[model samples]
Target: MGDGRANNPNSHSNNSSSNKPEWLEQYDVIGKIGEGTYGLVFLAKVKSNRSKPIAIKKFKQSKDGDGVSPTAIREIMLLREISHENVVKLANVHINHADMSLYLAFDYAEHDLYEIIRHHRDKVNQAINPYTVKSLLWQLLNGLNYLHSNWIVHRDLKPSNILVMGDGEEQGVVKIADFGLARIYQAPLKPLSENGVVVTIWYRAPELLLGAKHYTSAVDMWAVGCIFAELLTLKPLFQGQEVKGTPNPFQLDQLDKIFKVLGHPTQEKWPMLVNLPHWQSDLQHIQGHKYETAGLHSVVHLSHKNPAYELLSQMLEYDPRKRLTAAQALEHDYFRMEPLPGCNALVPPQPGEKVVNYPTRPVDTSTDIVGTISLQPSQPVSSGNSVSGGNPGRNGWRNKSWQHSDAARCCTASSSTAADKKERIRNGDDWIPSTTEIEALLSFLI
Candidate 1:
């Protein structure tokens, strides 16, 4: 079923039906854009409206032969509850009951920070514009603030996960994608250490490395801080080698890398430092080494006087409590300065600087999604499992998009009764829980 014109952008809409997966009839899948631990992602245009481009993410059924993976259900439920301008918008859902495969549709973003940073580093051999950096960070923090306010914690935040919209009315808009590791965190609950892995190694928070049983939104802040520094320097702030194993081994190397630049964590500086799960067991060897020679300002080339430096320091703080929250970071002096952050991250405020035309995300159309993953039989999808992924604007989510997106979007998720919801899913005859349906994911949390 692979297309001969795999690289031809014009051939994306051709739905030569022979051998095409019956489930994929609704979309003219252009090509596979990306794949990761979760599933494969395809670039497709709506068959009914070829002009509307969207990304279709396909996930294999759980190993237990259940309909949707628990993680995926959690992701979808969280997404349905999420409605923000800086958050990726879910468009539709496709469920292949034959193989228990689930497909989610989202607005196609042309650029992500990972590609943008790589382009600046490898292709252009230059630093990202300061105005552009500030704008991106501001939008990122703003979106994060909305998530935190809604009790959602995006544990896996990195350059690749932060997507920037392509040319459109929302061009230059920052959209935070990938909620695979996110969960609703209400205080006084069980420890979050159950899941083991969280943020990426390079962007991981210090407390997580030290083994904090109960972390908070501060973890996300640390990742944003790392991303902020990367934008300035075009390199990872702490490029640590992750140790792969079960039960999530203590990342000694990662902590050592962080300690080298930020110095050792003293009891007085971080009072709760001693109470961490791995404080005594993992940090004994590196306890006495005082790493003062390579401070953050010098590492990232930021002066101590600059507000950006201050913000970065707070984000990398060893103590989670000391770390800045998304709301507080957004109000910092860095964003209040001249050439302030604008609505469009691509359009800079500088008079002389020209707009940066970011490279489009690559697509490989040679492979087809029909036989991508081995098929398995599973039980029928449960009610409230299917998602149609409604438009955020139509749900009246735009006005308060910046506030609690999860809470607002979840309200609609709960507006329908169980019987009605079940009836709707039955009528659709597909298990598609599309959009940021945050509530569907709540059962997996806590």
Candidate 2:
């Protein structure tokens, strides 16, 4: 119940406030869940009711340096403002004066899209059923649509960031998480680029790659398109190698990979293409290549004429203006087709055979309930044999035994950066590494 122990005595200095916040005693800290760029996350429960589990995200706070991380502030502000079923809920906030740490309590999500997709592709040794895929995408779109309508752009929309409810009445419901890279795009002090690189390289839109200073929520749509393709193929669509050295705005290599399949974009196709800061340099490289437009079907392996493919194409459209908005994407006939998007992403329609039992999110039992722990790289653990235990509460998955002991890891589950992960995908390696390069890039810019 009461933070297990008092705040670390050494955490407070004579000049600093030693008083612990009132909310600190309210939640029973269970154990550490996972670490991120900002700070560590812990699985916890209300002291009054142990049955109700929640996730508490502790953001890093520096001593004798800056105050709370700006990213953390932005996340708190935006999350508190937006209330939607498809979005992760922020239930409470706690400030530990002893360490100046910011803690956010949110509804705990048992699984994420990355884990689900990886389980099917590598562990389950089968494709995720179309009904499941449709359901997840629909809920994702529903959330993204709400954000866009409210003039918010989820700059970083990737598999790892999309959370899925693994149990409870909200079981299988998809909730979009990680507002660290999200931005209120209605108006801004400067061009979005002034905030440094936004989306991850793999899901990054073409305009961002070409150094488009002023951008729109369409960037998020482009990412959703990439995510849709990944869901179907169980692999990133344009898994191009990230450019090293100084953060180049042109990113010719990434563009080359996209052009190879989607074909080169011309000024005629994208009216603003020629005006981008790095457009001239990018054009120089693109002009040398005679790349033919390879339709989405060739790369994704989906039905060439299916509504899903058509929608994918629209989402991955070269021109941001032409890309399907979340609202327009939801209106696509893909959702209207047979086997309509279901309420749950994991629930099988017309149940018969048993499904794979996914493991619960790994929780590190070693970490104590110390006030505001530092962000340390956790030892990568398989989804199976997590510290908290292995039962992923899914209806069809219960009582099913797995033949293989070592289940495949999610796309970003490992310690690899997005760029390195893309390289692994290119090299045909099964081990995928996941890191938020935005934080790395922002470190350089800041």
lDDT of each: 0.81, 0.79
Candidate 1 overall lDDT versus native: 0.81
- Candidate 1, TM-score vs. the true structure? 0.79
Task: Assess candidate 2 and give its lDDT.
Answer: 0.79
Single out the weakest 10-residue window by summed lDDT for candidate 2: 377-386
Candidate 2 lDDT at 37 equals 76
Question: How would you encode candidate 1's per-residue C-alpha lDDT over 163-240 as one tens digit per residue?
Answer: 998898888899999988898998535577687588888998888888787889999999999999999999998998
441 Cα displacement, candidate 1 (Å): 23
Residue-by-residue lDDT tens digits, candidate 2, 351-429: 7835557778888877865645432212323222224434455557545544344333433444457777688788987
